[model samples]
Target: MKEFEEPTLSADAVLAGLSLAGRVRYAAVGLAGLTVALLVGALWATEPSLPLRTHVAFGGIVAAGLGWAGFAGWTLTRRVPLFARDRVIAGVLALTFSGATAVGLVLVAATRGGTTAVLTASATGLVLVTAALALLVTGRRRRAELLRRKAALTGR
Candidate 1:
């Protein structure tokens, strides 16, 4: 009688299987990395705190950037042509998301008041903006991809 064991895969080979779990894991890692960077920046950023206008501006930028990231990731992974014009959009989206998170950290740090209000508000805003933009971008990318694929199949 003999016992056999499955061979282990190399790190690179294992990584090649960017399945749903892997993708999600990578995305999470990306988000976490961005958050840490932003926190550091906020800790170091100077001044009596950012104005409301700055918050709004940064928020908007974040939304746009996250939206783009979602869209680009969706398009590329799904092999969609909707946003095939440029890969820069994806990079921009990533940058914006990181910037927004960092600015939020600065705002939180600058708040003279306790973190109760700031933490709750920032958490809510972050979730809403991130989810909204990401979903919107993904939805649009999927729709566009479907349409393109359908057209190609039907010779439309």
Candidate 2:
């Protein structure tokens, strides 16, 4: 008997996946642009009349964070599988943001301006930071799960 072979799919059938992928990509691009715009606007809206030392410190923090972001991106791209990279990055970022927010809240409470009115915001910020921490934990779990699935798929 002749050996059986796999049937080939038609061109349209093979490549017709994700009809709205282009739209999704376009929307992602638009969203990314908007995020950048909002970030720049927030940075620009900083009070120019603030103390020179505060401005310098803010600049240093921004520079360091940007450098760290770049390094993280490089590490993710080189070391992470494409499918898991996003979750890994999101997890790492969420932890960092949550930790930073927690520190900020602590500092605010230690400062003289930590009145009850201002502390209301501290509660909200804390809640968000807690949620972010939860997200980070979930993302890490997802990454682990994905790794296990991949290993199983490869029979490793």
Candidate 3:
């Protein structure tokens, strides 16, 4: 008589099985979700004036976000020296850039005949961006701590 056993996989093993291309796909999907969110938010909160140019711009923004997400994920996984620093800077830049974009979108959406909508959208975008920036700083600090620990343990 012979007994057979099934193989078990560890979490690390499962994650390692995911190729870089797969990771990129996953990130793109996430970016797509965010794009949908932004589009929905725009439609929900502002007046309706959807145009072809606006849709195209939104698509571009989503593509950019997808690229950024893939790059960020790849860098995080590779864990190269100074990647954390770079991530933090990039994240801050992303927050500011996206925030500005959101403001512009909101303003255009709200534009009925005046700048009141623009001002309101700008304020909203500022708050959202500041929060995102704070999150980026926190992530950077965590990465810095991890790097310190690694250096100490390896005596590098």
- Estimate the TM-score of every prediction: 0.30, 0.55, 0.51
lDDT of 2 at 29: 42
Model 3 misplacement above 4 A: 1-56, 68-97, 106-115
Clashing residue pairs in candidate 3, if any?
Answer: none
Scored by CA lDDT, what does every candidate get? 0.54, 0.57, 0.62
Native-referenced Cα lDDT, model 2: 0.57
Residue lDDT tens for model 3, 1-156:
879988985333333334578557646655665666576556544745667666656655655565555555654465334424544765775686667677666757576535777777777777778887887888699767857766665578
- Leading candidate by TM-score: 2
Decoy 1 TM-score against native: 0.30
Give RMSD (Å) of candidate 3 vs. truth: 8.8
Candidate order by TM-score, highest to lowest? 2, 3, 1
Flag the better candidate by lDDT, 1 or 2.
2
Worst 10 residues of 3 by lDDT: 9-18
Summarize candidate 1's per-residue lDDT along 1-156 as a digit string, tens digits.
778989985333432334576457547645654565455445435433777766565556445544644553554365323332333444445446655665665576557546776776567667656765665576567556755755665578
